[model samples]
Target: MVLNELGARINTALQALSREAVIDERAVDALLREICGALLESDVNVRLVHTLRQNVKKRVDLDELAASSNKRKVVQSAVFDELCRLVDPGVQPWKPQRGKQNVVMFVGLQGSGKTTSCTKLAAYYKRKGLKVGLVCADTFRAGAFDQLKQNASRAHIPYYGSYTEPDPVRIAVDGVAQFRASKFDLIIVDTSGRHKQEAELFAEMEQIAAAIKPHNTIFVMDGTIGQAADAQARAFKQSADIGSIIITKMDGHAKGGGAISAVAATGSPIEFIGTGEHIHDLDAFSARSFVSKMLGLGDIGGLVETVKDMQLEKNEDMMKNLAKGVFTLKDMRDQLQSILKMGPLSKIMGMVPGMSPEMMQGFDADESTRRLRSYMCVFDSMTEAELNSDGKPFENESRLRRVARGSGVRPVEIQALLHQHRQFGQLVKKMGGPKGMLGKMNPAMMQQMAKNPAAAANPANMLKQMGGMGGMQKMIQQMGGMSGVQNMMKQMMGGGGGGGGMQEMMAQMMGGGGGGMQNMMAQMMGGRR
Candidate 1:
């Protein structure tokens, strides 16, 4: 959790409202006060916290609510929307253009994780099939070029920097020209970061900007800096045209909200957030998705996008089995392998709804990965008949004992694995079996859903179908619901995807649709534009 304390306080405040028989103005005011206090404690600027409180109060009008309306939903939506507004500055982030050389420059104060973020961004683009290169133009700091060069080498990205070049401007110009001549699609220049804002450093940044003329200048801000992020971001914006922002070291900060919302207020959309130290820890910032996850609504859209990018399109049998709502041990194995291919479980889990990065911190990714490997070993020990036995093998003590011996793993581990597999199969069967939940989807929506896994499991669509709170509770009861959902989450976590039931539902929802979830939801709600 980026701001675990704040998230917990907000959840507590909202849950209190849900417990109330009737939410009135007093309740709303109390909730806002608690939220305001949480924000202030998280180091959010006083003015910004005050604005958020006022905005939330303005949106949640007690007198305007009809007797028949669900006040909780209205209040929850208002809180969510206000949170989104708090971090969105109404600006579009810069996007790289294809078939053209895109130059991006990194600028920030020292100790802001500027140099590391530059390499991370380069690696991100490199992984996306872009011909990316890095240029180290930081002559002021000691070992600046060496650090960038080392990171670039580790990532296998082409880089240009000179230890002997005393002038940063010349190095930047030469690096850019060389990479351009080589036809690199994206060239990133890393500039010097000072201990603090200084006139000399600002002048140097301006000179570097003039020399290379970057397409985007990204100001990398340290997320742990609290309210000071605003001033630092504003200072850089003055020195250079900062087209985008990247907040780093977010995993270690409780005051991340202050840094994020403050930087957004500087009229720059946060393009990416550095969640961890790994090269792949960067996530593209989305206000709605971020806010949704913060409130436990989950980032279903992001989860689906992760699956899509995994290029599992060729897993036809898995998709077919999923469509039929038949999840076998082999299918679980396949899903686990797909998750392993995606990335670390911690990062994947953060994208899912109901599962926050904070709660996920309790489950170690390395431990999970090892557990998956152990489960696979157990799977390898089983005969083909045992693997496809559809829960029969687990009922027989002999097969379980044999698997335990052959896999060289403990019997309890094998038993636990079997138990999880059966639960997953039952849950999948409930979701996609004959007369399954996804089977009842509109033809148009299903057609569009088939293409995207995330869109298929869109929370918005689920919220619509369940008819809000009452309908949702009833539906949950019928589906063996929360327990089933928990099992699904455990299965996903075990598989290394961290999606839980939402991922399973989304996977089922794909009904094999190809268009975006928004279009599908529009058709379902008759709210299509």
Candidate 2:
């Protein structure tokens, strides 16, 4: 199983605890056992897993939790924080500054994905509106420059490499100098992947590092290597000032333990994660964001930054409307259009709080996309007044049929769209009032929070004001856990409809208000059904 399965298993264990009427030491130990077993199966080092187990046990005092209003929620929050601690080295990764040359060097074992990650990193920076360049300094590997050239060309990034130059050091110096002179914001140097056993290649790595003096020397490790990544990462760190790490091939069936081990090995924070083969697959690394996404909690700030990276035009009116708790069919339609503008449905869903990769896999991306477009068609067929109005305008059966005929979709789908609109509107109304989540948040601060999670972590953050982990949890509590997430997605994805979603299961979470965030994800992912 990959990390997705690992996350699923851990979630499954926690869900078991949610069922017990009483929370105690035995139950907590059982949860820890299941969680530790999942992590161990994923190739996490036994020692680390033991440490995590002990740490969580030490933190979640059952006696204290019993007195707490929501036992499961407090325990879940503890686990989330501990998981974040496991991967985060507590060191700040370096960021490139605009209008200044920032050189980065990549080194790792052969076939560790150093070459591809270099281009992906460059593309990530390029999308941020930075002037980025790539340098191929792998003289040991045949066609290394050719690979970098092909990848760079595909990403439309400026690159430097020589077919005739036999000295990798000279090429490294010249490439950095060229890009430095050209005023590139970020220049990435891709070195030949080498193990510590390769003395000459290790020397070459040192020479290139000395020449470029890269601000960040990244060690790329393959996530599938599991616990073995520790030694490889340590070897590279000894040879170079390996400032940060990038673990590649994480989207595949990686054991996932290797990623955590690599962090422990180098004591360097992960700067980025390569999720797929595409140049756009790279994601900025944050410990909180990673753990949240892994546990099926969405990263709103991360998603906001991603859309911002696209440099799309801002719809300020939409923000004002949302702040006022106003949501109409047009708002929902606008959201669908935005989803279309985003990349793959699965990738986008992974960032959503409730949808984990495992739950997302259950969905057909093409079909979900088609469903979104179909919703747009339904809206397009509606009269401007109808689109702008509340669902009172859709009560006429004849209007529903007319839209159904116009969009060539069943009337049921149109009804489903209206149902979704109603639910979203109700949820928004609850969240946007003067006492709601966005009430105290200025539109700009909300946007900034979405782009920078650190600000969101502030005590004065919007989620805090909303009495939530993000917002959905408290809102789910406030609304008494209306169970429609599954139905909403089932209609949108075309099948797999089931019972009351998470409503019946989590309806009791808000006893005067203590709904855990996992509550919303359970609702969002339909009990992970």
Q: Candidate 2 on 1-529: residue-level lDDT in tens? A: 1267777888899889999888888888999999888888888878778888889888888776546468788778878888888889899998998878899999888998899999988877777789999999998889899999999998899999999999999999999999989988899999888888999999999999898899989988888887787777888888899888888888845497766778887899998887877676777889888877776766655665665553323444444455567776775666556556555655665765565564455566666567667777888998989877777777999998998999998887777667656665776676566766666666666665446433343333434555445465555545444345434443444332322211212211110011222233434343332
The TM-score measured for candidate 1 stands at 0.79
TM-scores of the candidates in the order shown: 0.79, 0.73
Once fitted onto the true fold, the runs of candidate 1 whose alpha carbons sit more than 4 angstroms away are 64-68, 320-332, 356-361, 374-479, 487-529
lDDT of 1 by residue, 281-352 (tens): 787789887766666556656666666665555555554465467777776666666666556666766655
What's model 2's TM-score? 0.73
Angstrom error of the Cα, residue 486, model 2: value is 5.8
- In model 2, residue pairs whose N, Cα or C atoms come closer than 3 Å (at least 3 residues apart or on different chains), thus clashing, are 297-353, 298-352, 298-353
